[model samples]
Target: MSGIQYLVCLWILLITQSRFVRSDIQFIEKHEGDSVVFPCAIEQRNPAPFGVYLKRSWLVPNEILFMHTGEDFKMKYDHDKSRTIVSGDPINHTLNVTISELTTKDTDRYYCEFIVENPSSEDEHIPGKTEFFLLVTADTPASVDSGRIETCSGGSVVLPCLPAEEGLAVEGVSLKRQKGQEPVEVLYDSRRHHGNEPPSYSQFPAERFRLTSALGPGGITYNLTLQQLQPEDSALYSCQLLQRDRPDSHASLGRRALFVSVKGDDCSCSSSSTLLYALSSAVVVLLLTIVFVGICLCKLRPSVKPNRQAPIYEDMAGFKDLKSSTKLAPNHLEDTVSVYNNTSVKKSCPENHYESPTGALCPRNETQT
Candidate 1:
């Protein structure tokens, strides 16, 4: 076969495989910090399938989460060991896997395959395969609208937790501090214990956190007092209350969150410096605008050029006579004559020629010579 024929066959195979994969894919959406369960069913056979494989699909390589062979099961990844569980029932021909505490980073596609022995030959084949696309969205913090408090460093502040219903008896209370993506549990107070165990809160310092109960207008309020506050203490604090009547209910009875801001000693100075910087920027911008306008006006103004042409004498007749006389006696005069100025013309001309009021040289009427 030619190379062209091989290329065409490969392209057709890829398109066919892509369509088959798309048909088998299932999409699931959940919020962050939630749990998800995936169920896989296998074909009923005389002997159960040899093994099962659960993998997280990627562009180049796939991550193997669970691998089962006969009656043995193994979890391949250490990070998911505590959060992932896989169980299979040969009699029911079913496989189930559960993952808890999911984050946005866990959003990806997964593949589940069942391996079986081929009846005709001594080879293993995949009898069934399934694909899942898990989408984990960011979960917004709960109860941020309760209240906010601001305090300076080295001071103490109180965060209030109010009950959701007016008269429900509170069973347990927990406080968590949300800084970045994760919430750190600061305190947990369990009034009564049920079948399930409460969440642990051993990571934070016990001396710095205190949970106290107080009677207010509301039935009861739980206040979390944080002592010796530092700048790092500024964060969103969430309070959760579990009521005694709802032991089976997994949801909290009420959730309240408060924002706290711990300022440093130089906070005021920093704010003043920022204000001064803004004012300086405004002044600079105003000055630049004024200079630009002045430049534009100067360019647009009309230029007044000096009058280079000689000034015109008021008396044209006398000027004409003077010019004619000068032309007639050009060879007699050694010095250049000034016709416009009366004093200059008098020095060169006869005494009978006097200046008129209009500054024109005129000769008085001469008697009979």
Candidate 2:
């Protein structure tokens, strides 16, 4: 081949051999004393790959945590050897590194690299790589005394933002919410300004979050109000007070933390109240039913009317023959005479013997004697 054609052919070969691929960044968040696993996938190749490496890439000199060579695995750092484990599965084409008992110092960006020997050149080429960022947060003593608020969905609630230490001049306030894996900035208000300049205010969602301040005897009280709450709004809210250290500098004066719990609209208390109302209505209905039944029974029953007329003695002589009857004779005779003389019965018996001048017991007895 000619010298120029050989140079062109070699250039084409190098261009075809060297290739690069970049993946999107992944972010992870965790608490202190927790464990995390970084799973890296091995690129499939015809021959078994040469080696793998896990390193912290954000530092000036990349720190290698784990390395895999031909049939062997090792940890480079002595401090990490106790808490880190590196393993790989050749068949599944995966390399996994796990770190336990993590601390805030372990928070950094990491990358996994897979190297393969290039047959054409002496150098090794990275065929596969992945990167991720991890964040670890530690709990402070003040978090133990954080305030907690609970509210229902679609309702509004206010989170108080008072200085931890009193009598400090606060120039600004910032509120943040920590949900699952990220801390979101809710709002910020700057109270400091130059002459004739207005204060500054900013918020993530202006419609949902509002920051209001009130002047009181103690100092200015800043409150953050959340409207139309949802389940996702339940989170740990942090408030920081900013004070002007100098004309061009500001520092945090104090921090206060609050946790909020948002429930569904049909909360337990509302359900209980509804149940109690239903029971009360049922009781009232039952009482009304009983009263109605009693009234029906009273109206439906048959009534008895007194006769009002005295019963006349059929055998006056028989009554006089008995000794016990003699004592009742006067009252009985007076009752009989009063009944016989009644205007209502006088028409039927116009002249009764009890009312006769001859004093005969009865007309039939007088005729017989």
Candidate 3:
């Protein structure tokens, strides 16, 4: 046989085999924290072994859920491994997934893919995909609308989750804290044998969390009253409906969260803006006080008085007397020495000299000497 002929025969056989396989979708309706299963089937005439891959998607494809070779089945997304269960064999050509502890974020489309590698072919693996859409309904009626609730410390507030559905009897409800992707801290359960609290709620304030049944527009509304609200009481609270017969069934009707920004009563921490304002005011007052004290000190300080000067005429008279006294001292010594030596002396005074009242050298005579 020729090589071209063998390739043509293989191509025809693969085309014929691909026509026999088909994928199908299954629908599911569940509530939060309830386990739900999805079934996918692939039927073919040839029961040859194939690989299987499962993935979940919202608007875009997300994490891989399960992957199967001919012998082993492995969970591709390890974080969600504990919650996902996959079963069925290649011979059965079916895949079933049971997802436990569902949340609102889990509502998405799941894809079951069957892949086959053609014999002796290095090309891309042939894939066939089946899609399943999951619809998770809230346990409460759709009309009840409440989001985040804010309250102050030492005050009382109500977190209401009213079911608007008129005919459905209220079997039970579970109130819990939504811990990220799952629920944590069971606050209340109507189905529990010991009132509404579980053993996990021993540390929780039993008296502060009260259940109130009242009549509203939808007839009877259930509210969880929170008293003595502190900052620590802030969290996302979930109100889930429980089935009487199937006590394991948990679904959220609505969520009411608390944002406790209390003013006082142990919540004494002030806002950042208030702290900034106080610090700024203190700084301004300190600067102003310093300036005022400096001004007062300057005003109260003693002044330095300068020494007074003599009158101009008195100063001139004193200068003239100082000169005359200095000159007369020398002249008197000279006259004494002349008399002792017995010298015949001429008049010591110049011919044109005159004495003024101050007795200083006058340069020339005012009157004749």
Best by TM-score: 2
TM-score of structure candidate 2: 0.37
* Model 2 residue-pair collision total: 0
Model 1 TM-score relative to the real fold: 0.31
Which stretches of candidate 3 lie above 4 Å from their native place? 1-25, 45-47, 120-130, 138-369
Give each prediction's root-mean-square deviation over alpha carbons: 21.5, 28.0, 25.8
- Number of clashing pairs per prediction, in order: 0, 0, 3
What C-alpha lDDT values do all the predictions have? 0.61, 0.61, 0.56
> 182-220, model 3: which lDDT tens digit per residue?
446456455445345352342357877777787768577
Cα miss at 153, model 2 (Å)? 1.2
Candidates ranked by TM-score? 2, 3, 1
| Full-model lDDT, candidate 3 | 0.56
lDDT of 2 by residue, 1-369 (tens): 854455456555544543322444566656688899988776677555566777775422375554545465677767677888777743345778899998767766677766666688773545245666665667643342345566888777887776655676777766777544445655566766633435655554678877788998877888878888886676667766555663421222125555666767555566565566566557655666676788789999999897775445636545644644454456455434355556433222233334552334434435345
CA error at residue 190 for candidate 1, angstroms: 0.7
lDDT of 2 at 97: 83
- lDDT for each residue of candidate 1 in 201-276, tens digit (9 for 90 to 100): 4345777767788776745778778878887777667776666675433322235556566768865555655566
Residue ranges of candidate 2 with Cα displaced over 4 Å: 1-31, 34-137, 191-204, 215-217, 246-254, 268-369
TM-score of each: 0.31, 0.37, 0.32
- Select the stronger candidate by TM-score from 1 and 2: 2
